[model samples]
Target: MIPVTRELVTGIKLTNYKDFIVEHLEDCPKEDKLSRLKHIWSMPKFGQLPKKPTKLKLLEHTRAYLLYLVSTTIFVDASQRSTLISYLQLLRDLDEAGKYAWGAVALAFLYRSLSKVADRESHFSGLATLL
Candidate 1:
């Protein structure tokens, strides 16, 4: 079980995330910057996507869906509006992504979030659904 650290999560800056989106997504926005809590293909944009997408679009959609899932559920933060795009890096190769110890990472994040609450944080984050 590996410990989750700031570097493991928040280390990837927004610029890097934007760069990744541009490099990967064919339909990436020309602005090349992430909106407040919204990434290029955020959850809200899912419905607008083509029903019959190409292979690349399917992969992109899958990645976007997974990102929404993790950001809103397991690794959720206080704002709940934005997610650390660093997770996308791991999601690049879905097959390889399964190799990660996701449960351990979620547990570690939950523990960390709980510890912050003990230190006077007003709101609880992480996988609060477990509690």
Candidate 2:
């Protein structure tokens, strides 16, 4: 099993208004959490789910998955980015802004895993490469 850190879990809890998403996973009956998450994020400025998505229907699955990960999980505050930068100092995969962008995406996944917000199987796994 992949090891999840306590900090990651706490960060997610904070984001979800102290809801212990990990602890409640067993009770939540929604089997298709990914679909629900997609619907949630796809809502527009009025914050209402549309009868039919206005955007491209074919790519909705992938788009929803990415928004799900980005909106619900990832957080990159100053301190968090600093720590990542320090740990990955030797590598030069991205410049400052690029590194920060990647860090934000990574933190989202880390939060999702630690909080058990959605099954790991439901993640947008190839997002970084595709982007």
Report, for every candidate in turn, its global Cα lDDT versus the true structure: 0.66, 0.31
Report the number of the highest-TM-score candidate.
Answer: 1
In Å, residue 76's CA in model 1 sits off its true spot by 1.4
Estimate, for each residue in 18-88, the C-alpha lDDT of model 2 and write its tens digit. 13222222122233332122232234422433467554332333333333334433322222211111212
Best by lDDT: 1
Query: How many angstroms is residue 96 displaced in model 1 relative to the true structure, after the best TM-score fit?
Result: 0.9
Residue 42 shift from truth in candidate 1, angstroms: 1.1
Candidate 2 Cα misplacement greater than 4 A, ranges: 1-55, 76-100, 104-131
- What TM-score goes with each of the models? 0.74, 0.21
Q: Give me candidate 1's TM-score against the actual structure.
A: 0.74
lDDT of 1 by residue, 9-95 (tens): 322454555567655554444454453336434755653569788988888878777877878777887564765657777678888
Output the worst ten-in-a-row residue range by lDDT, candidate 2. Answer: 81-90
How far off is residue 100 in model 1, in Å? 0.9
